[model samples]
Target: MLSPRRLAATAALLAALTAGVLALLVTAGLITFGAAAVTVAFLVTLAALAFLVLIVRRLDGKAHRIDLRIKKYEAELARTTTALKNIETRLDLLVQAVEDSAARRADDLGAILASLGEDRVNAMARAREVEELRAEVRALARDSV
Candidate 1:
């Protein structure tokens, strides 16, 4: 669970330590400086590489978590959009029903108006016909007298 920063610092210190130990030994007439420098360079490179690898791994974990969060939000948005669509459909059906009821009521009102008009016209005609029959009867009775 060590971070890249800690690992790099540790590796760099270890490399310095090895170089110092070798130089001390040489001062004591033990090893060569050229070999010591070469070993120090290799250790430094290895430490840097390990640190770089650790940083990359940390970044990859962050990316995976971000991807997972994005996917979860995407699914939630999709579900909300579907719910909105369903609500819209229901509203549309309700509007259609309201319009149909209004149209039916209008048609019923028009039929009732037409029926009243016809009844008024028939009543006037019948009254005129009875008046004419009574006038004819009166004239025939006077002629017979």
Candidate 2:
């Protein structure tokens, strides 16, 4: 668990120290120069492989987090879509009720107007009958006199 930068620095220091030791061994005739070179190459390659693995693991972790967020957003979107559909259904019902109520009110108003017209005609007929009766009474009085 060292951070990447710390691990890299440590690897570099170790490599340098290792090369110095190998050079001293070669000068003192304890090891061949080719053997020292091969050893250094192997260590450097191993360190590079370790660094690559760490990078891959970190990227995988970030990708997992992003996937989780995407799933959460998709769920929220689904819920919102369902709620909007419910609202649309309620709105349609309300509009229908208002239209029906308006039609009923118009019908009632038409009936009231028809009733008033009939009342006016009946009043006119009654006035004519009363005038005829008064004229008949006056004629009878004249004949008797």
Candidate 3:
């Protein structure tokens, strides 16, 4: 389909051609000048009306296309928003899981450290008892000698 601007230009050209032909007919004495003038005027008016119709149709088509694009964009935006919300929900769950795991790990570490400290204290007590027995054995041997 021709664009509105192209259609208008075509209509103007046809009108000018019609006027020229009518003027030539008058000059050749084939028709009266007054009749030729009226005919040319009618043709020009028709061309103008056609040009206006083309313009109105083009504008309506443009408006319809714009409306369709707006609806499509709105649907895409809605989908994007929904996807973002889902992602946010998943991220929150993941963060909670990580925090819970860290807490459990800390508890485990504390228990292990407490067990190690108790073992160290027990070892020191055993060492002290062994040293006292050794001193008693040495003193008894010296007295007998």
Candidate 4:
């Protein structure tokens, strides 16, 4: 749970303490200077390794979190793609329906125009017959007079 900086700082502190103790032991004739120097070197190396491991672990954790986020985004993208496809299908169906309705309306309009043309022809014929009857009636009146 400790941050990398805090972990490294703790490791450095511990290494320093160990070096100090070794130096004290050498001064008190408990160990030789050459042996203490070697021991201090070894302790410093261990501390450095510990710091590196902590950094690597922190980076690995961050990579894990980023991987999770990428997976979530991919899932959302897939869902959006599916929704768009569904909308496109519905739009196509609606367009087809409109085309069919327009075709039906056009056919109905053609039928109405044909009926009107027939009615016009019938009216013209009736008007001609009425004119002929009027001329015959005038001729009969003249003959009587």
Worst 10 residues of 1 by lDDT: 2-11
Best-to-worst TM-score order: 4, 2, 3, 1
Taken over the whole model, the C-alpha lDDT of each candidate is 0.86, 0.91, 0.88, 0.89
Query: What CA root-mean-square deviation does each model show from the true structure?
Result: 4.5, 3.2, 3.5, 2.2
Candidate 3: tens digits of C-alpha lDDT, residues 1-145: 8866787788778778887888789999999988987887788788778777877988898999999999999999999999999999999999999999999999999998998888889988888888888899899989999
Candidate 4: tens digits of C-alpha lDDT, residues 51-92: 788779989999999999999999999999999999999999
Better of 3 and 4 by TM-score: 4
> TM-score, each model?
0.69, 0.74, 0.70, 0.84
Question: Model 4: what TM-score?
Answer: 0.84
Clashing pairs in 4: none
- Which regions of candidate 3 deviate over 4 angstroms? 1-17, 20-39, 140-145
Q: Model 2 — TM-score against the truth?
A: 0.74
Give candidate 2's root-mean-square deviation (CA, Å): 3.2
**Minimal lDDT window, size 10, model 3:** 3-12
